[model samples]
Target: MTTDELKGLKVASLVDARGTACPGPLLAAKKAMGDIESGEILEVYSSDEGTKVDIPKWCQKMGHDYLGVVEESSYVRMFLKKS
Candidate 1:
């Protein structure tokens, strides 16, 4: 989806892993996913460039829906729906 579309979405959780490295953001997202219920959305914020690819791959492997991402000035907001 477009960044604007993602901005309008209501996520169940928001995990800010900005300023960290590759595995850091991914790990944060995995932990945060546990707090939300099935079918709920999880929004992850990260400045790590790898997250653009990592998050989608993680979602695919974990059986979740990879919605899309929204890029901000310094960070990107990634959306996923727990399955």
Candidate 2:
């Protein structure tokens, strides 16, 4: 998918993966993204430490855009733009 595919996309929902373990956050992100429009953003919140690397890597592998992260003391939220 091209960058244009991800343009004009607003957020659809947030997937909360707090307290979950490896791959859970990514899995939750997938489920959330499935409910959204093709160009929408799916925000994922996770307490898993792997998310710092996993989220962006998953996006790259799937042709999505990693919008960046929002960090809270308890969790990290990642934004992904579907492409």
Candidate 3:
């Protein structure tokens, strides 16, 4: 989806992993996954630069649908659908 489309997603869960680093954001996404059902959307707010790559990779490895990301002034918003 486009960045605008990603920002408009109806998130089932939101994980504010901002200020956290590396595995922190990825771990939060993983942990938060348990709280959402299949097909639901999970929105992750992260500041770590690696998260821009980590999340999509994790989603791929875990078989989830990595929708897209929205870059903010100081952070990024990632969107994914549980599988």
- The whole-model C-alpha lDDT of candidate 1 against the native structure comes to 0.94
Which sections of candidate 1 miss by over 4 Å? none
Model 2 CA deviation exceeding 4 Å by range: 1-10
If the candidates were sorted by their TM-score against the true structure, best first, what order would they fall in? Answer: 3, 1, 2
Q: Candidate 1: give its CA RMSD in angstroms.
A: 0.7
lDDT of 2 by residue, 3-56 (tens): 334333457887889999987888888888888887778878899988889889
Best by lDDT: 1
Stretches of candidate 3 off by over 4 Å are none
Against the correct fold, how does model 2 do in TM-score?
A: 0.84
Clashes of 1: 0
Better of 1 and 3 by lDDT: 1
Candidate 1 Cα deviation (angstroms), residue 44: 0.4
Specify the poorest-scoring 10-residue window by lDDT in model 1.
Answer: 1-10
- Model 1 clash pairs are none
How far residue 19's Cα lies from its native spot in candidate 3, in Å, is 0.9
TM-scores, in order shown? 0.96, 0.84, 0.96
